[model samples]
Target chain A: MFEHFPQRVLVNEVVTRDGFQSEAEFVPTATKIELINALSTQGLNKIEVTSFVSPRAVPNLRDAEEVVTALNRNTDTTYVALVPNERGCGRALALDLDEINLVMSVSETHNLANMRMTCAQSLDQFARISAMTAGSAMRLNGSLATAFGCPFEGLQTEDTVLHYIEAYLEQGLHSITLADTTGMAVPNQVYSLCRAVRARWPDLEVTLHFHNTRGLGLSNVLAALAAGMNQFDASLGGLGGCPFAPGATGNICTEDLVHMLAEMQLDCGVDLAGLLTQSRQLEAIVGHPLPGQINKAGLRTDTRPVPESVTQLRQSLEA
Target chain B: MFEHFPQRVLVNEVVTRDGFQSEAEFVPTATKIELINALSTQGLNKIEVTSFVSPRAVPNLRDAEEVVTALNRNTDTTYVALVPNERGCGRALALDLDEINLVMSVSETHNLANMRMTCAQSLDQFARISAMTAGSAMRLNGSLATAFGCPFEGLQTEDTVLHYIEAYLEQGLHSITLADTTGMAVPNQVYSLCRAVRARWPDLEVTLHFHNTRGLGLSNVLAALAAGMNQFDASLGGLGGCPFAPGATGNICTEDLVHMLAEMQLDCGVDLAGLLTQSRQLEAIVGHPLPGQINKAGLRTDTRPVPESVTQLRQSLEA
Candidate 1:
C-alpha cells in the first residue's frame, strides 16, 4: 500500500508526438512547435516533442529534430523523445535531449511484429544502446510494451513480462515503464504486476503507459498507485497509438489525468485550466475533435446554470 | 492499503436509472426494460433499474414502475432503484426492490437548487422516508451528493461534507456513499476523506459516485480504493449526469470500470463482452454517438493488424 506518496502526479504531455503522429493529415512543423510551446507554458513537466523513428516509417515525425530543437524549455520541464533503435537513439543523443524513451514489447509476438525482432534480440539491442548511452547526463527510460496483454497473445503473464524487465535492469536502465501498448491492462493486473515488479526491483523507478483501450486506462493507473508505482505516461487530449495495432486508440488523456490528480489533491504541478486551454487549441488545430472529456465539459466551477428556456423545454417534455 | 478487499470488484450498474435520467430523451418503458434485461445477463451484480421520483419531476424516468415490473427476476442480481421521497419509497416498497437509494446533496446551495429544500429539511424528509421503510427487507443507501465539491458553493470543505454523513448515520442510514457530484475531488482528498469516513463509521458500506466532469473520476475512485474503500457507482458507456448540473459530463463508465477491475485480475462479475453488447444497444436506442471508447475500439486482443493497404498508404504518404 502506498501509505505515503508525494501528493503529486506527473503529467507527461505527448500531444505533439503521439497525438499528431496518429493523424492521417500531417500537422505542419510550425503547428507542432506551437503545440509544444503552448504545452510548456501550461506547466507540464515533460513534453514528448517527437519520435526519432525513420521518417519513412513514421512520416508525421520526420520533423522530430526541428520540433525538439525549437522548444522553449522551462527549467523545471523535461523534453523527452521516443527512440526505436540505435539509429533513432543516435538522433536523440545528438539533440542532447532531456530523456530518451526506448520501447520494446514483452510478448514475443508483439516484439516481432512491432520491432521486427524477438524478445531476446530486442533486449540485446537495448543492452547495446544502454552501453552506448553510459555516463551520459541524458536520462534513458527503457519502456516495456505490451506489458499488460497482447493482440497476438491472449494475456501477458507476469513471469514473461518481468523476464524482459530483468534484461533492461541488467543493462543499467534504471528508469523504466510498463506500457499497456494495446490498452489490455486492468486494475487487478496493474496491482499484481506493479506489486510484483516493485517487490523485485524496489529501487527501480516505474512509469505506467496506459491507453484508454477498453476504457480502463485510468483505473489501471489507480491500481498501480495502490501498488506503490507513481510515475505515469499520458498524452494531451488522450492522443497517440500504434498505427499497426488494430483499435489501439488514444492514450489516457493528459488533461483528464491532471484534472483527476489535482482534484485528488495531488500536486501534479501542471496547470489544469491552462492544460484545458491548450487542449482546446489542440482540438482546434487537429480539426477533428479529440477524445478528452474535460475540454468538452468545462470544470464544475465554470458551469452556467441551464437556462430557464432549456429547463422549461425539459419540463414540458417531461409533462 | 486495500489488501483485504474482495478480489472481485462490485460494479453497480446505474445506467437504466442514472444514465437515462441525465439525457433529454425519454427512453420508452419497453426499451428501458430491455436495456436492464440485457445488462442483467452481462455479469453485473447490481443494476439500478430506475428512479421512483415523481414523473413530473423527471419525465425521463416516469416509466420507472413499469420497467421494474417487467424485469426478469430469476437472476441472482440485486435490482436497485433511487427513491427521492416517501412517495417514491412507497412506490418502491410495492415492488420487490432489493435495494433503495435515497439521494440528497451535502451542500446547502445544491440541496436548495436540486430539491428546493434546506439541508435540515432534506434530512427531515429522509428521516420520514426512513421511518416509512424501517422494517422492510430492502436495503437503503444514503447518498451524499456534492461530497467532494459543489457547483453552487465552489469548493466544499471535508468538514461540511462529513457532517452530512454524520447526520445520515444518525438517521439509521448505514449504507452510505460520498459523491463527487461535480467532479471536484482530487485523489488525495478522496483518500483522506474516505479514510476519515471509514474511521468514523467503520461498518458503513461506503460506495463512491464520481463524475468525469474534470476527467478525474477513475483517479478519485483509485484514491478511495487505496484508502480501503470499495463499491462504486458507474453507468454504462460513461453515461448519466445531472442535467441540472451544467458541465457535469458523464458518470464513470461501467464498461470502463469493469474493464479495469477484471484486467487487474479483480473480478467484477461482469462479462466484458456482454457489457459492451448492452452498451452498444443503449447507444443505438439513444440514436446519438455515445461517449464510450472501448466499444468503438475493439478489444485489446483484437490485433487483426492494420490492413496492408493502410500501411502502404501511410508509407507512401511518408515517402
Candidate 2:
C-alpha cells in the first residue's frame, strides 16, 4: 500500500547532537551512541550525530569526534555533523563524515549574536571552507539561519535570504537548508520561501530545519510539502533547544512528524512503534519527561481494551 | 489589518472539562473557575466549563454543577456545558448555561462502548431532551462523536455521521460538531465529511473536534478550514485525553491553534500573550507540564535590545 506513494518524507534525526547539547547535565558517550544506533532501526535517512564546535564553547558535544567515528552507519543512511568554522571542519574531516553542514545567519543582528561576526565575514569564511571541501568524498551543505524571521530583526525578507543562497550556490555547495532557528517561520513564510527557492533554483537539494517554538513546526512542514520540498531535520521527542537562543523551544517531534506522514498516506519509511519505544528510553535517560506526544499515548496499533482494565484496577483498589 | 480576513477563527476552550477529567487527580473547583475566567480575558468566545455526568462515573468532575454556576459569564463570551442525559441536563439547566452541548457517538460500537447504549436509544434520548429544551434560551448543540473514526469500530462512514446530524436537526438542534474522538482522522476524511455535512445542512454551524493522537489534529483543522469549517474545540496546552478510550491523545493545543490562526492573518480575536500566561498558570495548577508550544517561545513580536542590567548579568555569566 505504501510503495505506490512517492518517497517524499526524509527524517533527519538530531537527537544525539542537538538534544543533548542544550542540557546542563552531561550525557555519557555510551548513552549518546546508544540513542544514535537505536534511531537507525527506525529507518531514518540521515542522522546529525554532533557538532564540531570548540570544546570550551559547547561542553556537551566535546565528544563529537568519538560519536561520529563509532556510528553503525548503514549504506543508505548518511551521517552528518555541524561544522562552524575551520577548526570544526578539521574534526569532521578527520572522522570521514558523509556530510558537513555549515551555517550562517541571514539577519545581521542574529549573525553577530550567534557567530560573533558580520554577515559578510561569515560568507567569506564559508567560501574558504567550501573551497577546502570541494571535490572531496564529503558533501558540503550551507545552512541559511534566521532565513524565515529573526527574533531581533522581526522579519527576514525573501530577497535577503535568496542573496545568501545565491552566494552559497556560487561557491559550489550542492545542498542548502533554510532554518527557522527561533521558530519564527509561519506557514505563509515557509510556503513562500519554498516556492521561491525551488523556482529560483529548481535542482537545489533544499532541506528544512524548523523548530516547534511557536508550534508552527509541523504546519510549516505541510507548507514545505505543498511547495514540493521533502527533506526535514527533527529531534526525537522534540528534545533539543538552542542554548544560545533565549526562549527557543524544542525541535519538531520525530514521532509526531512520522505519524503525520504515515497517515497522510505518504511514505516516510519509519516504524512508529519503534520510534515511540526509543522516545520512552530517551525520556528515561534524560531524567525528565521528554516533549513527545505519541510516546505517552501509543498509536492505533496498540489496541488494548480500556474499560475492562479500568474496571479491574478500580475493583482492585476498592478491595 | 486582521479584521478584514474572511475566516474568523473561533477557539472553543475544552480544558476545564475535557482536560481535567482525563487526569487521575481532582482539580480544585476554585482552580477550574479561575482558569475559565483567565481564558475569558484571552478573548476566547466559548469555554466548555464542565460536564454534567454522573459523579460516580467521572469523580474528577464531582463538583460540575458548582463549577458551571460560578463561571464569570462575561457578556462577550459564551459558556457551554456538556450534558449527557436528562439528569445531567437538569443540573446544567439549573446553572442557566449559555449553551448546552449534547454528545453521542456516530458509530454503533462506540456509542455502545462509550455511552453504554445503542445509537437508536441515544437518538431517542436526544429527541426527548430536545423537546424538554425547546423553548429555553440556551442553545442546544448536538455533537456527533467519532465522526471520523472510532476505536471500537475502525472507520465511520460519512453517511452515518450525516444521518446523526440530520436526526439532531429534525429534533430542532441546528448547531452540530463533528468529533474525531480517537484522532483517527486524516485530511481527506475531514474534507469529505465537511463537504457532505455542509451539502446536506446548508446553514448548519459545524465545529471540528480533533485529537492530536496521530499528530494530524492541526493538519485536519487546516483541511476543515479549506472546506470552510471555522470553529474548533481545543484544550489548553492540549491537555484532554479519553479515559474510556485508551491511546486517544489530547485535544489540539489552544495556544498553538491561536498562534497559527493569528500568523495566517486570520481573525481569532484571541490575545496570544494572555493565553500564554494562562497556559503557564494552568500548568502550575495542574502540577504537570503541558503540550503548549507558543508560551515557551514568545510570538513573532519585535524584540527589544537587551536591557543593560540583563546584559551585565549575561556578561558576568560568560566571564
Candidate 3:
C-alpha cells in the first residue's frame, strides 16, 4: 500500500522549543539540556532546541540561552532555535546555532496575536534578518503559522497562505514550514494545500507542523505524505499547544508518529523504544501523564501476557 | 482532493453497545434508552443499541434487553444488537431487531481470550445461528474481530483474515465488519485488507471498526475510504475499550469522526453539534472527561473569544 511512498522521511523533533514553551512551569535549563542531549542520541537528524524570545512574554522558556549554550551538541543532529524577529536572530547567531527558524502567521489576526506585528511587518523583519545573514553561514527556515487555519480568523484561503510563501521566498528563505496553528486542518485541506505549495515551489523544502487538537494530527501527516511532503515537525509526549488559542492541544506526538511509520514499514530513522524512554523521562519532569498514545500503550510488536482467565480456559479446553 | 472519493459514507453509532459496555458504572436502562433515542434523531442511519451477552461478563450492559425494548427507533435507522452466540441471538430475535451482529476473532489467541472459544468453535456457533435465522426476517452481519491485528497474536495475515471471511460467507452472512479490536492497525494494513476484501466480495457491505488506542483511528478511516470501504462504527466521545486488552483506549470518537468528515465535505448525514452536546451529557453521566478531541476543542466554525493580550496588542498596533 505504501510502495509509492518515499523509503525514508525526515522528522525534526521540536519538543524542547515547541513543547516546553507552552508549559505553565519553567523546565529547568539543566533538564532541557539533558532532554536535548538524550534526543540527539536517538538518531533524530534535527532537534529544535529553544526559542530566543522575550523572557516576560514566555517565562517558561526564559532559560533558552542557558539551555542552548550548555547543550552537548551531536555532530549528526542539527540543533535549531526559534527566532521570531531580528533581535531573536541576533541572539541565536551569537550562540552559533545550526539553524534559525523564523516564524510569522499567514493569517493577519494570528500574526498580531502571536507576534504583536502585522503580516507585512513580520515579513519586513524577516527580510532584514535575511539580509543580516546574507554573508554568514547561518541557515534560515521560515514557518508560516496558521497556514491551515487561525483561531481568530477561522479557515484561511490557499491564496492567503501562498501570499505569505511568496513573501518568504522573495526574502530568499527556501525552506518553509506550514503550521496548522489551531489544529483545524482536515485531511482534504492538508492534501490540497500541500499539493499546491509543492507544485508552486518545486525546489522548496516543505515541512508540515500539525497539532492534534482535533485528533486530525496524524491523519494530516498521512495526507501531507501522499501530497509529496517529506519533512515533518513533531514534539515528544505530544507536548505544546497554542498559548494564544484557548483549549488548543499539542503537536503530533513524535513517538506516536514513529510508531505508526514503523508499523507501516516506512523508514523513519529514529528508534521508537528510545523515544518512548525519553518520553517517560519527559513525563516525569513535567509531573504529569502525556497526551501521547504510543508511550502509554506499548508498541504493536510488544505482546501482552496472556490473561490468567484465557490460560485457564485454554487448559480446561485441552483437558 | 476528494474528487475520486464516494460522495457520502455510512456511519453506525455504536455508543450504546461499545461505549456503555466498557464503563465501570452501570448507566440506567432508562438513560440508555434516552441516549439511544437521542442518537436516532441525529441523522445516523444505524445504531448498535446493545450487546445481548452474558450479563455476568459485562455487568455494565446487564440491562441490554430493557434498553433495546424501550428505544424509540426511527424508521430510517436500523437498530442493531450484538449477539455473541445462539442464546444472545434468541434474545435479539425475540425483540425483532433490524440486525443481529455476530462477532468472533480472526486470531486464535484473541478468540480464546475474548470469547473463551476456539476459532472453529465460534464459526460452528455462527453457522448454527445462521441456520436458525434462515427462515426469519432478521438480517445477520458478522464482525471479524482483530481482523487487522490481535493484541495477543500481534498481527494476523491477510490469508488468515480471508479464511474467516470465507467461513462467514459460507454461513450466508453478507454484511461484514473488519474490527481493529486492539487498535493495532496502521493505514497500509487497513488500506490493503479493505481493498482486498471489497475486491473479493463486491456485493458485501463492508464496515470498518477502529480504535483510537494509538491515535491512528481516523487515519485508518481515511485509508479505508480510499480503499472503497464506506461503513464505519464509531462511539460517542470515544467511549469504549476492550475489557481483555490492558491500556487499549476507546473507539474513534463519533463526534470527532463526523467533525472531520463534515470539514472534508464528505457526506456522513450526522449532526456534529448535536453529537457534541450528547457527548457532553455522556461525560457528565460518566463522571469523567471523555477521550474525544472535538468535544473539548469545539468546532472549527467556532470563533474563539479574543484573548486579552491579543485585543491589547491590536489596540496598541492601531495606535
Provide DockQ values for all models, in the order shown.
0.31, 0.36, 0.63
Worst 10 residues of 1 chain A by lDDT: A305-314
Locate the minimum summed-lDDT window of 10 residues in model 1 chain B: B305-314
**Backbone Cα, N, C clashes tallied per candidate:** 13, 0, 0
Distance from true location, Cα of B204 in model 1, Å = 3.3
Evaluated on the second chain alone, the candidates' TM-scores are: 0.91, 0.91, 0.95
Residues B1-319, candidate 2, lDDT per residue (tens digit)?
A: 1122247888899998889887888999998888888888888878998899988888989998778778777888889988999888878777788888998899766776678666787888888888887788888898999888777566778878877888888877859989988877877568777878777776778888988876667778776776777899999888987653444357889988998888888889999888888888888888877766666666666465743554454466458
Which candidate do you rate higher for DockQ, 1 or 3?
A: 3
Expressed as tens digits, the lDDT of each residue in A176-265 for candidate 2 is: 989988888877678788889989898888899988777667778877887788899899998988543455467889998888788677
Docking class of 1: acceptable
Q: How much is A97 displaced in model 2, in angstroms?
A: 2.1
Candidate 3: residue A41 lDDT (0-100): 93
Clashing pairs in 3: none
Model 3's CAPRI class is: medium
lDDT by residue (A1-319, candidate 3, tens digit) is: 2444667888999998899887888888888888899999998868999888999988988888888888888889988999988888899888888889999988887788778888889889989999988887888999999888888888899999898898898998858899988888899999889889988888888899999999999999999888878889999999987654455568999999999888988888998889999999999999977889988778877777778888888899999
A-chain TM-score per prediction? 0.91, 0.91, 0.96
* CAPRI-style quality class for the chain A–B interface of candidate 2: acceptable
